[model samples]
Target: MVEDPHALFDAWLHEAEAGEPNDPNAVALATADAAGRPSVRMVLLKGHDERGFVFYTNRESRKGEELAANRHASLLFHWKSLRRQVRIEGPVSPVSDAESDAYFASRSRASQLGAVASDQSRPLDSRETFEERYAAADARFPDVVPRPAHWGGYRVSPERIEFWEDRPGRLHHRRLFVAEGDGWREGMLYP
Candidate 1:
């Protein structure tokens, strides 16, 4: 019976951070193309707030292209250790360049070079070609690696949020929160 879905999500995320052995912020992002073909992939959740959840990727990546065509997506966060999960559906929008720049700057130097070298979602003849490209990027930017123009972040403004917790005897607790005018309308879902 939580009034704030964001707050509940934050609390659950905190618990996951403490309990989950690996990437606690990892989430499955689902997207579709203009023709409604669906695709799902795992991405690290970079940030979250009342506005929405954020993640960064190459704008030319498969997921990014799908997002551009559809402009809406769903996210699923499952914490096996906690036997809990969160589902989010929302419209997607690009984050500001400033935000993307800041996050890009925080990444390791090697990662920065990889981001620049990769022509994500594009065909590559061989691994050596990619290695060469990466090497070139490394040599070109010995000091500061600038974030590529095609690399950026997207925010998903949630329209619906659902929380599920496992219980005994095949029973489970499921709560759904739909965005209302300025708040949320909470309800229960059979599980």
Candidate 2:
């Protein structure tokens, strides 16, 4: 009976942050190519708000390419310890370059160098080659590492959000919220 799905998600995520042992912000992101081929991968939730959920990645990566071809996507957040999960589906758009640059600047130096060195989904000849590339990047940017032009963040503007909570005797509580105009229409589902 929550009026705002974003508020409910914030509360659930707060509880998860306190209880989850690792990566409480981790979420499964699902995307599809222009041909309708689907792919799913785990990514950290960099930010979230009424606008939608946000995550960053290399723009040339497989997921990125897929996102470019198909803007619609889905996100799944499962908190095993709490026996709860949330599903989000929506259209996505890229975040501003300023946002991407700020986030990149906040990352550790090593991570910055790694991102610069990586070809992401592309095949690599060997580990040593990657190490060499990483070393070169580190040497090239001894001070500030600039975010690559191909690296950025994307925001998913949710059209539907579903929350599920576990209960006794195989019963569960499922609530769904669909965006309606500027507000949300809440409903229940059998689970």
Candidate 3:
């Protein structure tokens, strides 16, 4: 009986980093509106620990809005080279403003400007307009770009996590971890 899901995730992620050619940290974040309509998009996993999986985005963006409406969310990670994927379902919550600001400060200057310029998930008139706005932001903040109030991070506090590994002949392995009393209860599920 595996005890710690985070430890297992870390081990698999380390292996995926070595095998996956592209973004090993990429995960599909799934959220729903108040009406329960679902939407999924790729987001880079910024940080992960026992607390939750965290990713930063503009609060006005579609996912952020959806998360605001529906606290529950899901995440999926597929690593083709490693023939593995993980599914996570949990309630989501916003990270502290300090955390978001620190992460934003760690970003490249161009990225900071772009974050300020981008009205993420909103329609843009033209690429030129976006570039203009981006340039304006860059000019406005010649030294340091402050993190926009809408730009921040959210953490999904996992209630359930399942790890899957593909195998030949369609036979696969599935290990599920469900949060229990002060710990996790592991179960093997059919694939």
Per-candidate TM-score against the hidden true structure: 0.98, 0.98, 0.98
How well does candidate 2 score on lDDT at residue 189?
A: 96
Q: lDDT per residue, candidate 1, 72-161, as tens digits?
A: 999999999999999999999999999999999999998899999999989999999999999999999999999999999999999999
lDDT of 2: 0.96
Order the candidate numbers by lDDT, best to worst: 1, 2, 3
The candidate 3 region of ten consecutive residues with least summed lDDT is 1-10
RMSD of 2: 0.9
User: In candidate 3, what are the lDDT values of residues 60-84, reduced to their tens digit?
Assistant: 9999899989999999999998899
Could you tell me which residue pairs clash in candidate 2? none
The C-alpha stretches of model 2 lying farther than 4 A from their native spots are none
RMSD of each: 0.9, 0.9, 0.8
User: Whose lDDT is higher: candidate 1's or candidate 2's?
Assistant: 1
Candidate 3 C-alpha error for residue 147, in Å? 0.3
